[model samples]
Target chain A: MLANYGYSDGSGDYFITIDTQRCNACGACVMACPSQVLVTVDEDPNDPENDGPVVVAHGDRVRKLRYECDPCKSTANTTMPICVVVCKTFAISHSW
Target chain B: MSVDKQPEFWRWDETNWVNRDIEWINSEYITLGIDIGSVSSQAVIMCDGEIYAYGNMRTGSNSPNSARNALEFALEGATMKESDIHYCIGTGYGRVNVPMADRSVTEIACHARGANFIYGPSVRTVLDVGGQDIKAIRCDEKGKVTNFLMNDKCAAGTGRGMEVLSDLLSVSIGEVGDRSFDIEVEPSPVSSACVVYAKSEATALLRQGLNTNEVLAAYCLAMAQRIWSLLERVGVEPEFAITGGMAKNRGVIDRLCKKVGLEPMKTRWDTQLAGAIGAALFGYSLCRKGKSKRR
Candidate 1:
């Protein structure tokens, strides 16, 4: 599913955009990101365990973030990117 | 007397009847109570105004039968026969499935009664953290249940959550409470509320070279927070008694106490037997009432 969209680093700039409004904090992107860039924010003070931000893709441009991502690209040919494939709420997507 | 002259039925002597009645009263009889909870089953036997025997065992997937087995084991340990028991009472999630029980009671009522029995009449609140559920109940001066709140929809704050962490850490569940005492640094936070997601989060932390104790301590803190939220919603009072399997987890209890700003009242008596003990007490009280009415 993630491979349907192609990313090209036209200007060598990198960034991954996530729409927080659409994010349900389901953690699909955190698990799918091969570089371990995404992190979930922990909100509750009483709950020290559950207090952190989720992991997201790292970079400034959509193409650089998505195309140069070696793990997802390598796995994309034979298998769907884990984050995009497992997104039950469709909260995440590569910007470019 | 001739065979024909023998009475068809013999009449009992009043003196002999009274003597037999006295003997019956003197002989000790054991009554069993089985509590089949979501995570565990407990059996207790009350004999002659004392607790003769008791046993605790995991409920596994089949809870009803597990309760029966626990009861049987307790009876065996006490060197008593099942048929010798006068009555059986059942309580907890799978209480209704205890085929041998003459009656079944709710865990809330049973826990209140059990705590009240152990702690006397002063106890006002009971916090029961079982395998799959957490309950905070209030009681009146007479130990009657007032209002209560429960968290059964989620496994995040229950014994099952600790079990998951225990498996992940490759440590026994019994060690989790004591091992967490030495944790110095605050663990890297785990952000997921879901148990499955929490496991992944713990794994991620481990991959990052986080200490296992730190991770375990964080898990305990999270569960305490979840439990505290539920307790706060119901309104907690002093002299609060904790019961159920998770009550044995001192790490969680200590964190919860700090979060709630009050120390919980606990007893040497097994918390897991609270339901069964309460049921037996209720049964005994009812039997006494019946005798008084006859008199």
Candidate 2:
């Protein structure tokens, strides 16, 4: 139940990847996130196609992350956003 | 340089320094947190885990200077030198800009810890409406962040929006909250969501013969509603507490609490100093951890 959101602009390709199957929805990433870009949603509690509850980016933030997430990239300790680091399940990834 | 010539609009006098009733010389492990924010800065000094002294001041053009000045203000009345502090951690929008900080932590982490300290361990939710942004955070009993949401890109639901309205009505920013309640009836929220549009609409309302209090009531209502939407997205729970500058606005706080149907936890501590206090607490914990690790 992996989901991808966002698009490529003139600067680069930006995308936030969520692997629902691996996600436990502990929401540590959401808290670690400085910009509050991610949110948790209950797709369907008992549905087979969807994994109960998973974190996803807002429709509005998908585009804004291209600029919003840039601060995470500036530091040497982090190449990816802090959300990816705090996501213990390794369910979320970013493409830039 | 003439105080009489200055406009009262968009300006409010903030308490520059505060301290707990205690003797600092008796405590060990002194740590500090300098929070250099968009519109203001705070420096909090802690002995062990208890607050010793703090300073809250308006931020100047230079971030490092703001951080230093805040620390100096706090230390002015206290018997401590800059070199006597064990560690300095910076938090807020300008966290990394604090040249004197030994390290830095994000505002999210700092706010959660600060809220826990002020409101007790029961606090699970924190809503901070700062100068240029708003944050809704959910944390655990231990004061570690679990989930959070922020509205930083926009001016609405922030202190800047209230400042704009104050300037428009030619009233002191501090009086806007109290004046909102002076209206005969509760006014419906303004239609425009953007601060710029809302400001113009408020001006037009005045032109239509509505009084300043009425226009202010309308804006306050709108602000409460706007913040309510953001809080809804994150989901609200009991034991909620609010931080940052907007928490002082009685109108917004009362309206927000009524709409959410929950009483936000109260505190005697200054709400704006939450971030810096949290940072100082972090420094305190870190120092203890390091000492234990060495042993």
Candidate 3:
């Protein structure tokens, strides 16, 4: 399941897609996210049947991604988002 | 000195109605459901699984106050008092902010349950186009969500986008639907994926000698198309039902139905209260289950 979080507004689309099949509940993405946009939950809120822990975009920050992720996207030194770079499974991607 | 009241062109009606046939006082359990959505708020009061009364109103800046106002509006002219409510559940974007809610449920689950009650057991697909988001939900006969997808990030397919179009064209929100149909030829939809760009495109069309109604038709068509793509991703099923503010708009609904080749199931109750109705029903069931557990 490709869980896409965030929204498209008048400005543009800002989404964080997580491939749940590859995610192993690793907290690396959570720790790497400087804006605290990701969290590891015991259950996937979108998938009620999944009982295992998985990483998901924070609910509160989903709507405010443009602002919350501004620091990382605006910096020239960073080649990629910290969360995407740190994910060993390569299950995370962004649509900006 | 009293200032002259200004007319709010974009304002929709807010009202409450009670089922006079139900004698709520004698009911063993009375449950309340409050839905504090981004654009509107609703409160539903149920007596023994039957809808006793419901109030629909525009959401205020403060969610707690909005919930309180909606509940008070529903209780107005009724024999029941706040103390009579045995259980309370809240749903919607501001669900957690409801001061009186004993529990909170997701709007996705609440809408499925509420649609089952309002549209009947045959309903399998629910499309809720709310103020800031669009949700396409598939549910079982028992109103349990089987699968669901939600898009809250964009304003292109939402009520907020419609409101902006209405205000831009100086058309009342209620008349946008009917007036859109009045145009002789349906213009191609506005060529923008974002509401901001669409607004500018609408202004350009107006400059190019398009009438207000014609411009409205184009925008409505775009909105319908935008929503249709989302529904396609979720796979629409038979006995489809639409809830929330968009349910009341025929301009988008009619076009979308024509494109999808399926008419939406109708409901007698106000479509905006679907979330609240589901919340109240859930509360009632929880109360019953809790009672049985204690025994």
Candidate 4:
């Protein structure tokens, strides 16, 4: 299941998407996160039956991604965010 | 001092320190660390390896001015000037904007290192409740960060949240800690995690005939709970120590320690200066490395 974190604004729609099905709950994403924007939940938000808890973006950070992630987003060129790059499971993706 | 009468709930009146053990002239290297945070700023000057002078002040509107003023306050009454400092490292939110700093470091790294010095090598966990955020850090003996967690873009579990309650209750910021413990009955924690909603919750409790102290106690408990969850994410291990503005709030610290079942490591220095102290120590190492490399 895909769960999206972030909001739409005047500029455009931005999001940090987490695919729980693809995640293995390895916690690499959580450890690699510099800002602690992602955390491991006890139970999967997207799947109650899955039982395997997974990492998801912080609730407080979900709304302010555009501002909070301004530093990580490369304006000069395209580059994956640290959270996206570090996730070996390829369970995370960002839209801008 | 500004003649403003708004009750300065955000104000934390405290003095800076300068260790007398070091003589600036005799030291081969003099390095400085400036931590410019959202609510406060600090500057620490180290002569050779020991602390020489330091300043702590409320941050101003402009970060550059705040950094300069904090350093100047530390340098006050001393013969040394800014020009005499060999190197400067800036840390915290405004680290990049420090006009005088040679480089900048993250507050997380700086806090861990500072906690190491203040609380000793046993501090495996550090919970820093600064102006707008809470950080839960796990560091090794050398003060290197191994793992950490931080609250994201929220002021709910930080110094700003306490200041909001202080303003709402018409109580001085310094008085919040002592007044909270004065309440006879332990109130339930406030329901809301957001500061705005928490204010309304607090107002409702007050209208429900709770005394001001009772309401304050409730808020402190709620604040402790909010940060406690963040600490859980990092998986707390002792010896634990706390740093930043919230460390001064004994009510919260005592409750938090009780909730977590660990006694915090003690430190005589101001907890708010942890990031600056860490940055200064980093500067000391950097200067020492430079001198050794040159030789």
Candidate 5:
């Protein structure tokens, strides 16, 4: 089971991580992300139609720091953890 | 007569020089006009019964900067310095920023003047569609603006609307006109009036296997319909002239012609420069009047 890291920032530093291999670019996560953090990389110069969420590095991977994450929920149907309750991919999960 | 009593030739030289200076002052000199519109800015210099120079540049979210750049470009195009400009007039959304302008006139007035200048004084109706707004203005025989209507709230029929559609179709704005000309079938219905919604609708239409030409034609028709509604408010008249950035779009131009039941007159000169030309003409008129008064 993949443990998802939960954000503790009261300033709303939540983020949603997406696995490009699993994402279909069906816009499910884009629609589910309430904070508008999860955007489809539609116009990437290198990869125009890459099915991945735009990521921004805030803190070290191992350390806990204030970071803004995608608000998209993940579903349990796949190996990915769910970020929201209605994720269809089950690719996103929250853990602290 | 004594030689001392004769008028001095040196004094005559000064008098002749003053008279020549007065004559030069009385003669009409060139004037500059600047028009800063939503999508582009233009500058025109009118001298000796012809357009000495004209410059058009994209207005990238800053009207003032665009106007200045256009003015500088026009000056350079004419191979003349800015200090040679006798009078300056400004028109359009950013007209107020023309620092050296003698007066600032409304875009309606400028468009009217420009249209009348090209199509003669009989032109009564003018349609100006720019990047962000659309306007329908009616002018009297003298080229003074009378009744007018405009659409400034939505991006439905403006240049920005076409830009959104162009992006959705993965085509450049320049290609939309020619492609729409080839559309044989009626375009799919586009329900959204907002740009974002319309973009999504366009994407959906593409997914449904609609051809690019058909979709583009549909967008043009939608924009033309909105413009038609605005024109209806002003009451279309004969000798209608269309001017602005979007006037170059043959798709919209042809649609407007069919809807209005009259062919529009478009000049070879830059359509976006209409406002600037009008301002320059107005400046020339003011200078002429001032000179007559001083006489």
Candidate 6:
């Protein structure tokens, strides 16, 4: 399951898509997130049957992603975000 | 802004219902679900997986108070006390603010589960248009979300957008659907998806001599069209269900159904309670699994 954890506002789409199958709850992305936007849960909230730690975007921070991720985007010459770059399994992607 | 002229036209009835058939006091697992939405709040109590009682009311500015009020309202005249509940799950935009909740779940999960319970197991697609956001969810028979998308940043597709129009037109929210249908000819929808632009466009149409109902029809159609595109992105399936404040608006649902080419399944349960009910049901499952209460 590709869980999208952001909202589309007037500005544009701001989402962090987490591929549940590929993510192993490594917490690399969670540590790399500058805004504390990502966290690991004991079970997948969207899938009741799936038990095991999985990374998901923090609920309260979802609506604020456009603002929270702005600093990284504004930094000139910066390529990918730290969260995306730290995911060894390449399970995280951003839609800006 | 002038404050004196209009009544609370957007005010919908705040209500509660108790299932007479369920002997809740004797049930082993009593769980509560509180969904504190942006515009309204709901409380639902389940006894052994069946809905025993529920309450719905407009949300106040303070979310924690709204949660308490909703729960108290539902518990009124019932034999159950707040302390008797085995577990409670909070959901919706204000889920984290529910004072008595043992845990919090996202509205997306709760709505899908609640839709499955209320609309039945066949419902594959759930579209919840709440006060400030739109959620399109694809779920399995068990009500676990498979795919979902949400839009909250824009007011154009939310109930708040409709409320703004209702106030601008001085039309009671309750009468919007019937009045919108009373028009002689359905005008093309206002082109803007932004609420400010739509409001301006609506005002312009009124200046152009279109009646209130005609203008309403245009806005409703536009809202339906916008919602339809969101549903398309999530991919609608059979046995689709619509819930939340917008479900009561025929002006929007009828047009949306027409565009989707499938009639939405009807529910006897109050559509607003779906989130709370799902939260309560989740609490029930958690209790059955012997999960330790957090609170």
Worst 10 residues of 2 chain B by lDDT: B286-295
Q: What are the chain A TM-scores for all the models, listed individually? A: 0.52, 0.84, 0.96, 0.85, 0.40, 0.95
Q: Which candidate comes out best when scored by TM-score?
A: 6
**Ranking under DockQ, best-scoring first?**
6, 3, 2, 4, 1, 5
lDDT of 1 by residue, B1-295 (tens): 6565533111111110011112223444446678888877888777543566777777757766787788766655244567777777788888778888876766767787778887778888888988877777777666666655445545667887787788777767777888777777766446533466667877887888877887888788877877786677557888888888778889799888987788888686777778777776665654555521211
lDDT tens digits, residue span A1-96, model 4: 455565443355566777776878788878877667789987753222234678878877776777777766855664878778888889988877
lDDT of 5 by residue, A1-96 (tens): 111122322232232333334445566655654444444544321111122443221224312322233222243454432334455665443432
lDDT of 3 by residue, A57-76 (tens): 88889989989988779889
DockQ of 4: 0.05
Candidate 3, lDDT over the whole model: 0.86
- Candidate 4 chain A minimal-lDDT segment of 10 residues: A43-52
Taken in order, the candidates have interface RMSDs of 22.5, 12.5, 3.9, 13.6, 26.5, 2.2
Candidate 1: regions farther than 4 A off? A1-96, B1-30, B291-295
Best model per DockQ: 6
DockQ of all candidates, in order? Answer: 0.01, 0.06, 0.23, 0.05, 0.01, 0.48
Decide which is better by DockQ, 1 or 6: 6
Sort all candidates by lDDT, best to worst: 6, 3, 4, 2, 1, 5
lDDT of 3 by residue, B6-45 (tens): 5666788999987888988799889999999999999999
Model 6 regions lying over 4 Å from their true place: A28-37, A45-49, A58-61, A64-90, A93-96, B1-5, B293-295
lDDT digits (tens) for residues B1-295 of candidate 2? 6667758588766565545476666777888899998988999999888888888888899998999999998887777778878888898888889988887777877888899999999998889989887777777798876666555656676788888888888988888889999988887778744676767889888888889998988888888888887677557877999999999898788888899999988999999999999998888887886732211
Model 5, residue A62: distance off in Å is: 56
Q: Number of the top candidate by lDDT?
A: 6
TM-score of each: 0.65, 0.77, 0.82, 0.76, 0.66, 0.89
In order, what fnat does every candidate score?
A: 0.00, 0.00, 0.22, 0.00, 0.00, 0.57
How do the candidates score on chain B by TM-score? Answer: 0.85, 0.94, 0.95, 0.94, 0.85, 0.96
In candidate 1 chain A, where is summed lDDT lowest over 10 consecutive residues? A1-10
Q: For residues B1-295, write the lDDT of model 4, one tens digit per residue.
A: 5866665665778567767656788888788889999889999888875778889998999999999999989988878888888888899988988999887777877898889988899999999999877778888898877665555356776888888888888888888889999988899988755676767988999999999999989989988888886677567998999999999898788889988999988898889888998988877886676632211
